[model samples]
Target: MVNLNAVLLISFLLFSIGVIGVLIRRNALVILMCVELMLNAANLNFIAFARHSGSVSGQAFALLLMGFAAAEVAVGLALVVALYRKRDTVQVDDINLLKG
Candidate 1:
């Protein structure tokens, strides 16, 4: 039998890795990918719990989160394109235009 707790633990580990990547990485594209990874990790946990508990609510919530994540990816990619066009680089630290 598949262990639900193990699945949840793996998901949590994946999320932590993504968080660390976002905090430490300088490249915009990499950071965006890491954000997606974190979102997916949460989704995995939701679905796993939903299946284990014999309830559909968690699955439904996971689906909803997936939809939002898709939209977020669309907007985030657009921003990345715009930023790349403007600066010709994808480093987040270099984006200090609004700084005083």
Candidate 2:
């Protein structure tokens, strides 16, 4: 019995927080976590709209997005580990592997 407007508002707030976190945080891990937060907010929006419109496509897309986010996290973490091993730091400004 939750209202669609309320769900949308919550999702928007979550997404905004994630964006701000990503923008303000300097650690790579924190940035990745913020990205996950944003993805979850999008999934919430998908589920809410799916329920509101009486369709399963949005839910399906949300599920797929979850899988994609999982893979992205895995890859991103691996890269961070590698960078930390090579550079001894995970700060966004301290490591520059793409300076070419």
Candidate 3:
């Protein structure tokens, strides 16, 4: 049987990496990837706890979270594409506010 502590530790590590990446990276694509990593970490936590407790609620929540993440990615990528088209760059610092 897998240890719960190990799973939790791995999830924490993934989340930490994602947070650091988001804070340090300036590229819009990289930041989006980091956000996805963070989401996956949360999913891992939910699944691990659900298995440990022998309950499906956590898994159900994880599935719902996945749907939200998918929608977020779709919208985020659209924004990034729009930004690239307008600014000709994907660097976050180079893009100005939505104000025209």
| Cand. 1 Cα-lDDT | 0.95
Shift of residue 98 alpha carbon in model 3, Å: 7.7
Q: Which one is best on lDDT?
A: 3
lDDT string, candidate 2, 23-81, tens digits: 99999999999999999999999999999899999999999999999999999999999
- The TM-scores of all predictions, comma-separated, are 0.92, 0.93, 0.92
Stretches of candidate 2 exceeding 4 Å from the true structure: 96-100
Q: lDDT, candidate 3, residue 43?
A: 100
Q: Residues 21-85, candidate 1: write the lDDT tens digits.
A: 99999999999999999999999999998998899999999999999999999999999999999
List clashing residue pairs in candidate 3.
Answer: none
Over 4 Å off, model 1? none
Residue 85's lDDT within candidate 1 is 96
Residue 78's lDDT in candidate 3? 100
Candidate 3: where is the Cα deviation over 4 Å?
Answer: 98-100
